[model samples]
Target: MQVFNVDKEKTLNAALLILNKLGQADYHKIFKILYFAEQQHLKNYGQPLTGDVYQAMPYGPVPSFLYDVFKASENQASPFSEALELSKAFTVSRKDKIPYVSPTREADIDQLAETNIEAIMASIEENYALTFKEITDKSHDSAWAKAEQATETEMSYLDIAESAEASPEILKYISLQAENHNLRIS
Candidate 1:
């Protein structure tokens, strides 16, 4: 598996879009929706939507960087500068011991791709109202199970695509993209 850098601006815009679409939602809802949406995008395209890696968490697959960003929005001390930036877009609060995010403004739609929006919208519609058990079961796919017992296990895009049953041709394309991306950054 190759490593790829995350696009924080695109990620922020994507998360904002989800929050705006869902209004105020709990951490589970936001992260789970993102997890599913990323999987769909990986299957349809050779790339992920947010380009942020996912971690197999108890709730399901959570975007690792966005997890930190959400923690930062919650006013927890974080080394990431995006913490404050995320806080500006979403006000995070706790109710009955569960944390929720409320969008402070509309999403930067110009920053999001049409297919990405479609994936997320479908995920929201499908997953937003699922029971905790339903979502956990749905999200604990092969990819998530691979890292389930590990702490903060970072999931690779290739593994995610594999679990989503992406075609061999698509997987090869994603691998090529990863190589090109690594070469560009390295």
Candidate 2:
């Protein structure tokens, strides 16, 4: 089994990078649950070490970093087996809670959501019970209109958010629009 060795800083950095790249919604939807526990693992491993390995050994190629870490930490006072156990539990919880989808399917859904904001909003309203008033107030209608014009052709929520920074009020509306459609911040 291969294990990846990572220090607390490196582990935390990697996770944060992934979170930033993935956006809040996708991070919450897919990465957060998996990661919060990982954060706990980092917290528990109090000292910096030469190496640590397979925080969890699920049925796959042990991440090289994990394998290296495990191998390096073999003689340490407290190796990563315990943390690996927790990670395993975390993985099991995730696997039992949600099924994995192919990367292609994931990308297709992401593209569709980005390009089809209206439909995405409709679905959000239906599924998450989102409300228009919850997102925008009367004061922001003018700004919203202006932003709407800019975004009439471009379907990216990230673009809309980028362009519509007239005020906090306007930003709220943009956020609501982007969030309703599951748009990632670009």
Candidate 3:
């Protein structure tokens, strides 16, 4: 399958939107919500909400690029420094070694589709109140389990597609297209 290229700015805005809805959350909670949103979109539409790659982290499936963006935001680094403007968008504080993130600015919801935003909102409603460990435990579904067994940290979209029960014909077509286009599956 051809790996979808994620629009970082759009994804960041979407993440911020979720954070805005939740009021405040730690990294683990934020990542779980994003992962669930991506899984829902992928299962229903054959495409992820953010088009971001996911990895099986110890805590759960994490949107890899978004995780990096969050880290950069915490560190006050380059690209994210300009795009996210963490100082304005969020306030970070440590509570017993875990950092809590709270949104200070409204997310640019214009960057995301209404349907996608709704899906994220639904995910937030469903899982937002769970403890970080509870959310992480819930995320150990087949997709993450499969990725956890892989030698590489990055999980394949094909794997997720399969776990989502995408039609065999669709999977075959994707495989053929990947071969024809010389696209890497993972």
Candidate 4:
């Protein structure tokens, strides 16, 4: 029930790192990979890898902040502009139905844990060849369906945890305590 605060810089760096590792990929594919990584991390660690809010869009689940960063990078805006420029990652063929990302510089991989990177890489390897529709279909799991049922745009971590069915009881107890104390995880 507590809101998790996302570190925009770290999230952007992680996104860049994923793109750098995977080479160029379409936006939808990138989002799907991120979603799968987040799911895996949440299942194992009781927290998401990037701490990014997910939205059940028509296409699939998307990390909302990362999507915004990608859009901002396209417009050359502020932190996103600087980060993408310095990282040499850019979105190409925006007018196309599927925009591709080309990462030319090394990402700040230190921002994320090795486990998270591994999960991301594993997700990429497993589903890289799948088309956008395939990825989207894969993402329509119990968590996404539950969120969609509630007419929720932003998918809840609690819902994801429940769907993953791997959250430790201790963690759930601690989360409940934190919620009761009005403390948010950041």
Q: If both were scored by TM-score, which would come out higher, candidate 1 or candidate 3?
A: 1
Deviation from native of the Cα of residue 88 in model 3, angstroms: 5.6
lDDT scores for all predictions? 0.82, 0.29, 0.75, 0.72
Candidate 1 deviates by what RMSD? 2.8
The alpha-carbon lDDT assigned to residue 148 of candidate 2 equals 42
> Model 4: what TM-score?
0.82
Clash pairs (backbone) in predicted model 3:
none
Q: Worst lDDT window (10 residues) for model 1?
A: 177-186
Among the numbered candidates, top TM-score falls to: 1
Across residues 1-186, which tens digit of lDDT does each residue of candidate 1 receive? 335667777788888888888889988888888889989998999788987877777778888778788888888567877766676777889999899998888888888889989998999899989988899899999888877765637777887899999999998888888776672211
* Alpha-carbon RMSD of each model: 2.8, 19.2, 2.9, 3.4
lDDT of 3: 0.75
Per-residue lDDT over 134-153 for candidate 4, one digit per residue giving the tens place of the 0 to 100 score: 88898888778877776556
Tens-digit per-residue lDDT, 1-186, candidate 2:
212233443432332333233332221222222222232222223111212231211221122343332233332323555444323211111244442211111112222222232322333333222232422232132223443455232122222233323345544564565466564322
Candidate 4 positional error at 78, Å:
7.5
RMSD in angstroms, candidate 3?
2.9
lDDT of 3 by residue, 85-178 (tens): 5344666677998878877688888888887898799899989989867898988877788879888767776676676677886567656655
Off by over 4 Å in 1: 149-152, 183-186
